[model samples]
Target: MKIRVHVSLKPGVLDPQGRAVHHALEGLGFEGVEDVRVGRSIELDVADNTSDAALTDMCEKLLANTVIENYRIEKVG
Candidate 1:
């Protein structure tokens, strides 16, 4: 089985990295760029029998920082 995780900063959080990218984009003449936010995606291959509880633990411990971000997990064969 394969597990994919997406982690993103909350809507109200300040994203300095994203802001820098946005500024660079504007400087390059890319018009209509409204806002930007940075996030990360992690892919993991685990046994098919891995439990949901264990996956959640992995996200909590290593995949995401819950203090300022939210994460979603998807399982694929």
Candidate 2:
């Protein structure tokens, strides 16, 4: 089975990379842009029998920083 982990900074956390990208977009004369938030997508291949709890555990332990970030697990195929 394939899994996709989407990780991103939580609201209220400052994202320097996102800010930089937003600034660059503005510099390029892009208008009507409100805000930008950067996130990461991680793809993993595991056994079909992998449990949801295990996946959640992986995110909590290593995939995402629970303090300042949020993560969503997606099962793909």
Candidate 3:
């Protein structure tokens, strides 16, 4: 089976990359841009029988920074 993890900074954390993108967009005349955020996507392949708990453990331990970031997992295939 295949899975994907999406990791993102928490609400209160500052995202410099997001800000840079927003600024670049404005410079290109893209108006009405309110806010921006940056995140990451990780794809994994595992046995079909892999348990949800094990996947959660992977996210909590390595895929995401639990202190400042949140993670969401999706079973892709």
Candidate 4:
């Protein structure tokens, strides 16, 4: 089995890196560049028998920082 985890900043949090990227894109003359937000995706290959509770624990323990970001986990074959 495979697991895909997406970690992103909360809506109200400020993302300087993302803002910088957005400015750079505009400087490059890219039109319609509304907003940019940076995030991370983690892919895990684990046993098919892995439980949802364990996956949630992994996200809470290591995969994401709960103070500033939110995470979503998806399982794929």
Clashes of each: 0, 0, 0, 0
Q: Give the best candidate by lDDT.
A: 2
TM-score against native, each model: 0.94, 0.96, 0.94, 0.95
**Candidate 1 residue pairs in clash (backbone atoms < 3 Å):** none
Error of 2 at 55 (Å): 0.4
Between which residue pairs do clashes occur in model 2? none
Estimate the Cα RMSD of every predicted model relative to the unseen true structure: 0.8, 0.6, 0.8, 0.7
Clashes (candidate 3): 0
Candidates 1 and 3 compared: the better one by lDDT is 3
The total of clashing pairs for model 2 equals 0
Cα lDDT tens digits, model 2, 1-77, are: 99999999999999999999999999999998989999999999999999999999999999999999999999989
Point out where model 2 deviates above 4 Å: none
lDDT for each candidate structure:
0.94, 0.97, 0.97, 0.96
What's model 2's lDDT at 52?
98
* lDDT of candidate 1 at residue 64, scale 0 to 100: 93
Which portions of model 3 show Cα errors greater than 4 Å? none
User: Rank order by TM-score, top first?
Assistant: 2, 4, 1, 3
Candidate 1 C-alpha error for residue 39, in Å: 0.4
- The best candidate by TM-score is 2
